[model samples]
Target: MTSGPSSAALLLLADGRLPAGGHAHSGGVEAAVVDGGIRDIGDLEEFLRGRLATSGLVTAAFAAATRRSCPANGPVPDGIITELDIELDARTPSPAQRAASRAQGRALLRAGRAAWPGLSCPLSAPHQPVTFGIVAAAAGLSPADAALAVVYGAVSGPASAAVRLLGLNPLAVTALLARLSPDVEATADAATVLSERPPADLPALTGPRLDLLAERHRAAEIRMFAS
Candidate 1:
């Protein structure tokens, strides 16, 4: 019999259909599409890549750090998780982005509670990545697994949004995601390594463009996405 942790839980968390309210937000893609920053599959790839390198990295590292802060078989540390939340808030400069993350976090927390009935999250409304980390830990996933999930979602969410916003071919978008897998793995690995740093020392890579896009999306009168 296998004694190691199973990958099924990780897969469940990463699945887009997990009812985490990820569908409502495009991760800034809708605003970018409205702003003419992405017009085709090629532009979408570039945008996803940029996101993977910037906010993606920060999110992955913070998720990994949060996972590390969680104990394997005990109550979650509220103090450490609170510190991580504040650090994540600091890293995310845009108010719209922060609100969007917390909204998703709340949704994910509900899903997490459903999946793991005994799950005890410290924060009522944690950031999305922090919630992801806490849920990942409860599901018996490693920090590296949590990091990979965040980076993958970071790109995949925008990629999926591009399909609806631009009418891009689903096959082409899937192919584009396949092509970016290596970079995603590398980014996740880097994030996992950086997770060893203190909460305040985690990667603070900011995406000013994404922040502006989020702000613009928030103000759009007839927008499809909430963020």
Candidate 2:
């Protein structure tokens, strides 16, 4: 994969402020917090670490793989993107998580189209990481760049929610993220290497608690975050 200085486009995509509808979702942290799985800063740290290890690594891998699937100048093939989407869906067993992913994907697709003309995917709503990979490629980002954005979002999303859900100090939360930097980088590096494999061969590590929390959140009559 081609490498260069971190492009401004990468920053734009990775920024949490991007209007991709991600702010509404907490990456399952809201559900966990409500379920008593996270009550303080220490619990939040462990949750973020677990998330980074499982879904974070898997999403990063798919993002890298998807970026490789889409050529820099050619239109993405329907069959190939579909296969990747299916593979990601299989990895996410929770229906709530699948629905949340598609919702975010649709929002991200709309935002990407505004910034990168001609950016289109076969599916109206692909998985979030798949859309992320496609958009990253459209913005002239490398596979590793895509992986970086995915893994970062994997933990950052939950951390953002934890602050709101648990009333955790923002400074502490930011510091926690700073401390997790090495882990985030390690996860991204591993994902980039795993991206060299076929989509079906990618890792399928999961957190059952995340799945249960997603289901519980979906059923809750009162909720702060979407999932």
Candidate 3:
């Protein structure tokens, strides 16, 4: 309601180094490597592209919607948030992935609450993207910024993991990320269009291979990333 969040807030949230426990998760890259879905930078490109389109778009939409739902003043409505949570659950088909998202969400909430108490987030256990939107609202950012932040993380997390998992050159990986920025922005814009949609009307984009990898990652006795 007030001036939407500033560009500084957007940068802070999009920062991969932000202490949200995101470094520990690979955004499914670890499982993909274990499953032989990714072997080199070429394969990583494909994986990143698919993730940016599917899970990336879906989560970004939720975050933008959540950002839009927050009131400029007064307590947040828990009922609406509850419905949003359910919508998130409906979109994510994998239990392991769900737990992973909630974990990241909780971590981000902790950081966000400490950083900006003004946002007055209502939930203790939101999906990562949902919490991200609330944090953006608290930071005074717009829905478009929220979408960009979450979508950027969706791709960057895995790209970073690819560095560790595959021992690929970081410079090349970064360049790949730069090349993909246009798609990320496009996806963010598309999500912003649906930010005001009803929860039932939110995007439902599932990645079957990612889901299977998450399940397999959960069962693995020894794993590098959380999900």
Q: All candidates' TM-scores?
A: 0.97, 0.97, 0.96
Write model 1 residue lDDT over 160-207, tens digit each, in one string.
888898899999999999999999999999999999999999999878
Local accuracy of candidate 2 as per-residue lDDT tens digits, 99-202 = 99999999999999999889989999999999999998898888899999899999888899999988899999999999999999899999999998988998
Could you give me the TM-score of model 2 versus the true structure? 0.97
lDDT of each: 0.91, 0.91, 0.88
Better of 1 and 3 by lDDT: 1
Error of 3 at 179 (Å): 0.7
Stretches of candidate 1 exceeding 4 Å from the true structure? 1-5
Candidate 3 — which residues are off by over 4 angstroms? 1-5
Q: Which lDDT tens digits does candidate 3 get at residues 160-206?
A: 99999989999999999999999999999999898789989999988
Q: List the residue pairs that clash in candidate 1.
A: none
**Count of residue pairs whose backbone atoms collide, per candidate:** 0, 0, 2
Q: Best candidate, TM-score-wise?
A: 1
After TM-score superposition, the amount by which residue 124's alpha carbon in candidate 3 deviates from its true location, in angstroms, is 1.6
